[model samples]
Target: MRVVLAEDNVLLSSGLKLLLNSQGFEVAAIAADACAFLAAVETHRPDVTIVDVRLPPSFRDEGIRAAAQARRDHPGLPVLVLSQYVEQEYAGRLLADTRGGIGYLLKDRVSRIAEFTDALRRVAGGGTAMDPEVIAQLLARGGDPVEALTAREREVLALMAEGHDNAGIARRLVITDNAVHKHIGNVFLKLGLSAGDSGHRRVRAVLAYLRRYGGNAPDATTPHH
Candidate 1:
């Protein structure tokens, strides 16, 4: 697959280019600043774009801004935003777009070559990958951003990520089916997803869950969420 990489760190940039090349992935373009990054995407229309959250000029969220802009212009191109630390707010912004094919991972994860490469492939295939640290952060504060949910509701969340349905979650957690239903209600309420269509609620909830704990998908064990 073709990729456009954006990072201001020269050593890391060259290292990543080499790594990707050795792995047989074509490096279609590379940029050191957000402006150049966007221009390259517009020019190359690469299959995926790997971006560092901190880039030239502000050295803040330039990468994030670029990712958001690229998503706006291209609509379906995959974007992976790398950062040194987890920022829940930033992850939320990325997930809010819900166009599929977005990722938010820690910069250090690039060293885990296998997983990082897989994440890029996933994003290119229209899947989400989030950093584990971000997942732990969201799980630690699992509740309605607007309202609090019960412990049972949180348990239901953990089970949802486990690929459980109301019946399955009820059985696994030893709760009544009705109880699981109520917990689902509370989850939707707390997450401010109550008004969405029924068919899409579960997907949205999963997106919220991933947005919360995604940086860690390379590892399945739910971090202390």
Candidate 2:
């Protein structure tokens, strides 16, 4: 797959490029700032883009803004954002798109080559891959009906948000598939998400979790360059 990477840190960007290349992904372009990142996206039209949450000029939310703008210009553009910390607001703003093909992960995950690559591919294929830490924080701070969930049900919901299916969750939690199903059912019920929901139940649940904090997050429409 072709990838356009946006990161201000020279060493990190170079390392990521090499890593992506080694994994059979073409590094189409690299940009250090929001403007340049948008230009690269327009030029390369990469299959996926890896962006840092902070970029040059302001070193604040430029990367998130750039990614959101890119998605606006090119709907359904696959983006995998990397952050030094778990910034829930940023993650929520990005996830707010809800068109799938989104990923938010901590930079530390880069060290886990296999997992990182898997997430990239998942996003590229029009899937969601949220960082576990991000999910945990969202669940922790969420209000009712999320507060109504039991501890185990919360764990199941968190894992579900991380792009894990029932089998995957079962293996991670060392529980039976039936138990995972039961916990997920309870999560859906507690969250008031019904079988008639428009989208995939799992995705709806994750979106519900994000909506708890998304209300306070910055709007995705960033000032154009």
Candidate 3:
């Protein structure tokens, strides 16, 4: 897939371009500032954009704002937000449009190339790829929104937030597809996300997961993969 990368760090930008190229993704454009980033996106219209949360000048949230504007300009544009911290508020904004094709991950996770690339592919293909640390932060702050679920059910829901379908969840958890379905059904019921189509319900469940634990704590050491 073609990609537009927006990061202010010069060394990291070069490294990411090389890494993405090695992983079969075309780096269509790379920019170090918000305006340049938007220009690249407008010019190349890449399949996905990998963006840092900060950028030149203010270096606060310029990149994310640009990404949001890009999505508005071209609805459903895929974006993978890379950040040093787990910012739930930013994540909420990214998903506010409810159009999917979005991801929010900590920058350190990129070192796990296989998982990171898989997340990029998933987001590009119209799926969610939230970081486990972000989920953990959300979980730590929320009042156990999913406390009704059994351990296995919680596991299934967690995998769902990681962009896994029934088949993938089954493979990872060593469960039958039927069992996965049953657990997911129970999850939806418990989370009050049963009112929509399966795809919509999945997105709602993920959103619920995020809002339930939308605390501003530092990320946990736990790995989601």
- Per residue, candidate 1 scores C-alpha lDDT tens digits across 108-150 of 8889998788778877887667665654454653233523655
Candidate 2 per-residue C-alpha lDDT over 16-129 given as tens digits, one digit per residue, 9 for 90 to 100: 999999999999999999999999999999999999999988889999999999999999999999999998789878767768889999999999999999999988988888
| lDDT (0 to 1) per candidate | 0.74, 0.82, 0.81
**Distance from true position, residue 50, model 2, in Å?**
0.5
lDDT of 3 by residue, 1-225 (tens): 899999988899999999999999999988999899889999998999999998989988897899999998989999999999988678777756568899999999999999899999999998988887766665553245566767777677667776788898888888899999898888788766754676646766766655555543233234324
- What is the Å distance of residue 23 in model 2 from its true position? 1.1
The whole-model C-alpha lDDT of candidate 3 against the native structure comes to 0.81
Better of 2 and 3 by lDDT: 2
- On the 0 to 100 scale, the lDDT of residue 80 in model 1 is 86
Superposition TM-score, candidate 3 onto the true structure: 0.88
* Every model's TM-score: 0.71, 0.90, 0.88
| Per-model C-alpha RMSD | 6.5, 6.3, 2.9
Q: Relative to the unseen true structure, what is the C-alpha lDDT of residue 3 in candidate 2, on a scale of 0 to 100?
A: 100
| TM-score-based ranking | 2, 3, 1
Measured by TM-score, the strongest candidate is 2
